[model samples]
Target: MSSAHITFDTTGDKIARRVRKMRSSAVRDLFAAATRDDVISLSGGMPAVSLLPVEDVRAATLAAVESPEARAVSLQYGPTNGAPGLRAVLADMMRDLGIRVKPDQILVTTGAQEALSLIAEAFIDPGDIIITEGPTYLGALQAFSAFEPDVRAIPFDDEGMRMDLLEEELKRIGKGNPRLKYCYVIPNFQNPGGVTMVAERRRRLLELAREYDFMVVEDDPYGRLRYDGGHQVPLKAMDENVIYLGTISKMLGPGLRTGWIAAPESVLARINLVKQGADLCGSSFDQIIVEHYFKDIPWQKTLQKFVAVYKERRDTMLAALEEFFPPEATWTHPEGGMFLWITLPDYMDTDSMLAEALEAGVTYVPGNSFFPDGKTGRNSMRVNFSFETPESITEAIRRLAKVIEDRLELYRVFIEAGALPGYDRKEAAMTDEKTPTPWEEVVADSEQNEEAVMQAREGNAEQIDIAEEAVRDAQQAAAPAEEAAE
Candidate 1:
């Protein structure tokens, strides 16, 4: 068959400019790669659906779908304000968080993703300033980018975003930009970096927002998934002015696509306008399912199941990190949530390392995609511990550590020759002083180059060898008999 020549319009300046300027999000593309079965993905902030209360949800949904009343809500159109029963339950849940919001203040959206987009559509004008953490939620960044907001990023430390830096940025913006709409934060159990903001910092942040006369958009989907200890109150609990975002995607399941935003009545009104224009309203069927799921089913039991399962996964990831990462790497210890942040030496780039790690048979989200300003965090990566089995976490972390060690060694050579200035020198310095190894550093580098590491087995590498032996045994058992025999 002769090929048909296709003609395309390439002359329209506006369309060409728009097409050239707009690009698909890096995170979205990364998610596509994460779906590969061969890829041990520590990327994408995905909850382990294997642990979801699926059976209960399914049963609740079946009951709801079977009921004549449920059939009407499920089959017919739903209110833009969401199902009244669901709204009432959500309002009560909000009250538990110390927000005395009524059901009228709630807007149910498809997901927190839709909630963010609606909020941006309602509040963010072109050229308006919206501050975010240095490494914030990629989904939020993508959602706000559509509105052409001038996004500003403030650096964050372990305690969360430095209030001093935020205050300084606020003052600087005040000098020129008074059209600051809001500051977005994931104060409890943040995505990509599982650091929780201290309660005092939450208070200080609200104080800053009040002083600056700006809104605080608190996106909290992971707070309810805490594994290790006493629960921390959400930042929204501390401020009546805060716009609170909550999702069942993590707790129940993402397939439900159910999430709600608790905001001031004025903001809720605006959000409703934007939301109505978007999807009309979230799934009426899903809203009814959620309500019945909460009412008829024992939600407390389901939540407990999630807590117990995810806590095990979290511990597994921590143990794997201790067994595989290089000595020069450091990672966050999350109290709750699916992600943990890893910071490599300055000379390492996580984007480059991602290619190498994937080639070596693992995957992680590069840190650059999370930055609103796209300025720093290149030498970092975000790993999700909630999706894969403990075995997968171990293998992924091990491969990643090898990649990091090789990169660091290459950088060390350049540094020794004075070609790289910012490379870490403390590794050599500590040896010169014969200082005791930091337990933290040891935990970071458990997956150094196996050959070189074997030689240094006298220096804590022995423990790694023992773990490797166990992995070998496990792999051997799973291998085909013919291959195993060979």
Candidate 2:
């Protein structure tokens, strides 16, 4: 065959439909820009790996490889369900959290990422309804998107997912509807929003699950990382209907890529079958190393240390926000976890302002991506405090504040000049006492300058000219009043 006839565009047509729908992770994309020495990144759900107990990890690795029996298991292929010892260790850990599960109930995967994927694979079907918090974890949204589920996001408050709103939605969907597959939640230190579910809400959620006859995927990667708060029990602890996801990524390091799912054996069996097709099994050596670390090291002490370091960073960021940010800006005060959400004025779009923020030497994941439907959260962004140092975070917040102030001022000018399309004068007057100049008045006063105003609106001429002319006219109009008072 001729070369032209044989040539193929693999990405153009050969790619799977699901793969084509996958969008690049916003946090991952920001990593490249964040690497610059001058840039302070409050992006990415990254833990401070530098603070991890280096000696303990080194010792664990040695024990896993140096011993003959351990070496054989580490190097060889293992069971698809995960190594026995690791499951037992995790079971014991879960017991501490009040979740009673046997080793057989657990299905180990590459990481929490893969566990999410496996769950999505086993349960999600096209057009199935999957409920999540309004500003939920982006990674989970990405995972479920491949399966083409109808993702419905419910708004959350400081206490977490509004059960009242959930009940309303559930009522709409009707009780015991098979089309409703599952509800995914980050109960402890939820991603992006950083709001933990309160005990009352947790109980109500289980009750809803029971009434609605659906599953709850409880993602608890950050549950143990609480810095300052009373410990809230995981939903799985209260009920077995929850499919619990646990990870060593936040606690130890993400490099291990080890995570587990504690679910009913029936569900786990289905997940195991899907996992077999996905990757067969997780890394044998890494699982063994984690098992060793849990057995030999004071893991609880390590968790305490992580809390101390991250709590300082979180506090620093919060204090800096209070000192530097505009009064209109508001943010979540998370008790624990890597992220806190900030909401800017409704007129501000974080997505549009990202380039300016990056130019100002800081980066954040714009909040819109966290919403599955992408219809809201335009005025918000998720700020991560776990990766950067306190000094870096402080400086980053300062830069971000400047960007917000500049953007807000520009937006105000646009609205006042009637340069912005669909500007509502009545709404502006009600919200702020500074009444917006009528477009007709602006036009009537500047009849000779009509060409300039039109040019400014069309981007054919400088906007500064229009703003300056309006300011000058307003000042000139006020001069007589000031003289009369004198």
TM-score of each: 0.84, 0.88
Error of 2 at 361 (Å): 1.4
Give the 10-residue window scoring lowest on summed lDDT in candidate 2: 439-448
**Can you give the lDDT of residue 102 in candidate 1?**
85
Model 2, runs deviating above 4 Å: 1-10, 417-486
Task: Report the C-alpha lDDT of model 1 over 174-283, residue by residue, as the tens digit.
Answer: 83356899999998778878998888788899998888888999999988788776777777777777999999888778889899998889888888888888988778
Instruction: Give the lDDT of residue 54 in candidate 1.
Output: 65
Superposition error at 314 for model 2 (Å): 0.4
Clashing pairs in 1: 324-447, 325-444, 325-445, 326-445, 327-445
Tens digits of per-residue lDDT, candidate 2, 297-330, equal: 9988888889999999999999999999987678
Q: Which stretches of candidate 1 lie over 4 Å from their true place?
A: 1-23, 175-177, 422-428, 431-486
